[model samples]
Target: MREPAKSKAARTIEVINRLAKAYPEAQCELNFANPLELLIATILSARCTDRQVNVVTARLFKKYRSPDDYAQSDPSDLELDLKSLGLYRNKAKSIQSCCRRLIELHGGQVPRTAAELMQLGGVGRKTANVVLGNAFNINDGIAVDTHVARLAGRLGLSAHKLPEKIEADLKKLVPQEKWTLFSHWLIWHGRRRCYARHPDCLHCEVNDLCPSAFRFD
Candidate 1:
């Protein structure tokens, strides 16, 4: 008699369960008090760490509390305020443009659906997914950042290189209720353990279940 082959869904569930236990307190690290704030934060998070985004938003959020503020803001002034973050000029433009659309289309509130949110300037699928999942508690799709994409391939959860394809692969394996938390867990783990280089697999919590575990060792 041979051992049974583990189904992809079963393997994913086991991985999720272990990760949930390992990171019981895992959540979105980006600080935001509202959907609009989260939307802005996510846009600024491109090529920037959550810590860096939070630092800039601390003052930025205080200065611009509403979509109207951003819509009314001077582009040069906004760029100056966001100078600390790389690509400040483009990000500032997107923020202002997105806010303008919010004011003109949605009355200055972040849209709840992914489709509506994506229509805003600078709000791509990844950013829209982040706002939808973390801010609105709507699991429209998994937020596939660099970390998620890397972990998905390493853990054999997804072979797709593109975030959208990876997100689709993950959505099929992980349960809908766990979609939001699943992304969070992978992100937290990627930052802490399964790093892009020099992963510390010696103490990885899910090493036993991870097919790519210790490949670097």
Candidate 2:
């Protein structure tokens, strides 16, 4: 007979223990000095790597240190500055619009709440969560990125596919204080071990607790 499913609490504890031991220093990989920089980086990170975002932002951050700088920048120049990233034109527009709103509404500062942050042009639930968690140290909700979503499914922490539903499921399973860290752990694990096409299950630290382990073997 097939074994009974593990209790949500039990599974969560097991998963957390293994991942925590494996990646004690797991955190957001995107480099940013402040909330505004983080907000801009997260927006530019859509369908892009954190390394690329950091490389671009190193110069972008120096050039546009304040919301007013971005708000007043020439769109063409901004697009040219971000030409290295995919979807540069759209990202530039979003950044310009978001900064303008920031200046108009929050007086050139990043908003502290998800609701308000989402009101910005390029900001969404994921970006808002990243900023709130890392920049503001608020564990409002988990940022369900591609890595988190994939690992959540593989680990059986969440059966849902959509980010919103997956985040909801994760919220129920993970502790409130760990919301932010949980996303980071999963993201780190996904990037390091649980690849999309071929997961390194044999040497994976959470293999024992992971139901999908060694399916390739």
Candidate 3:
């Protein structure tokens, strides 16, 4: 039998409820002391793991203190600092350009709103949402990463291809207060059980709640 497409609210609530129950201690995995640090760390986190980001940021933070530090550094040198992560060239350029914008317009502070942050180089919806939820304490929206996107489909929560569309669907299901935690929980579950290659459905805390779970068979 064909399954019905879930409404946005239904999907959001399911993702939120299951993920929240699965990972009760879900929080931002990235380590940062302030909003500026979180913003910079989030930039470095593109296409990289949080552990890798933390390793990179440990040294990068010591070398660069503020937006001016990033803005003033030579791009080539900054790229070398991030060489271990690879894709350093583009990431370095983005960090410099984005920091320059922060200095020139926002007076060295990370912008809170997604629209404003998106104006900065490499600041997409995910990055903007991370800053909003973590740095600003406004959990208005979920930041749909690979984990959230994949789990949303596997759990029959969302069928959307685009992260933005999936995020829209999730937004409708989850209340605003739970958005950030819900996103974090899914990320935790992905890392802990539902890996890209294969999911450890048996180890999953909310496997019973998951539509994709095959244990019933």
Candidate 4:
């Protein structure tokens, strides 16, 4: 039997369809109740896990409620709050500047667009994608974190060195409507199967669709 000679778009749709069914509960694991919380969480998530960030923010949020509050926060106190995450110094400065910019330009509210979020000091494409997707409910771009990048390569969806390049490739193949879900689904699959150290392809829900699937005969 000949395999389907479908285009990249077709495979993308197929992958999304199968995985969406498998990961119906896929969503951001970051603990946030508002846009400001999400922005701070995404920033703290740099080189950190959602679990760790959540533990820290459980207290951090209480101290800093609004952008202006963060803008006026003392770096020493903020650093102490984030020391466990490592790189606290830079993150502290970034959050301070990020919140300052938010107050100065955005009227103390988190911007809804990726471009607007990018104007903040600490926010990049990945952070912008997270804020836009989770906080503002906008699917303007895919959130290409380490999980998304590794899974995309393992699944043969994107072949690129940089996350931005991989994001562009996936965006071209995936429909806009599925971009948000695609990111969440890939994160679920990554956390479950395509792990950073070892991928348990044998137990993967979309093992057949994933190129890394185990095929023992």
TM-score of each: 0.97, 0.96, 0.91, 0.94
The all-Cα superposition gives candidate 3 an RMSD in Å to the true structure of: 3.1
| Most TM-score-accurate candidate | 1
- Residue by residue across 34-74, what tens digits does model 1's lDDT show? 98889999999999899999999999999999998998989
Over the stretch 99-212, how does candidate 4's per-residue lDDT look in tens digits?
Answer: 989989988988888888999989999999998888877889999999999888887888797999999999898888778878999998878867888778777777766666
Candidate achieving higher lDDT, 2 or 3: 2
All models: lDDT? 0.92, 0.92, 0.85, 0.87
Clashes of each: 0, 0, 2, 0
Model 2 agreement with the true structure over 91-165: per-residue lDDT tens digits: 999999999999899988888999999999988899999999999999999999999999898888889989999
Candidate 3 per-residue lDDT over residues 80-127, each given as its tens digit: 999888788989998998999998889998888888898998788999
Cα shift from native, residue 135, model 3 (Å):
0.5
Candidate 1: residue 80 Cα off by (Å):
1.4
For model 1, the stretches where C-alpha displacement exceeds 4 angstroms are 1-5
Ranking by TM-score: 1, 2, 4, 3
Superposition TM-score, candidate 2 onto the true structure: 0.96
Displacement of residue 173 (Cα, Å) in model 2 is 0.5
Better of 1 and 3 by lDDT: 1
- Tell me the TM-score of model 4: 0.94
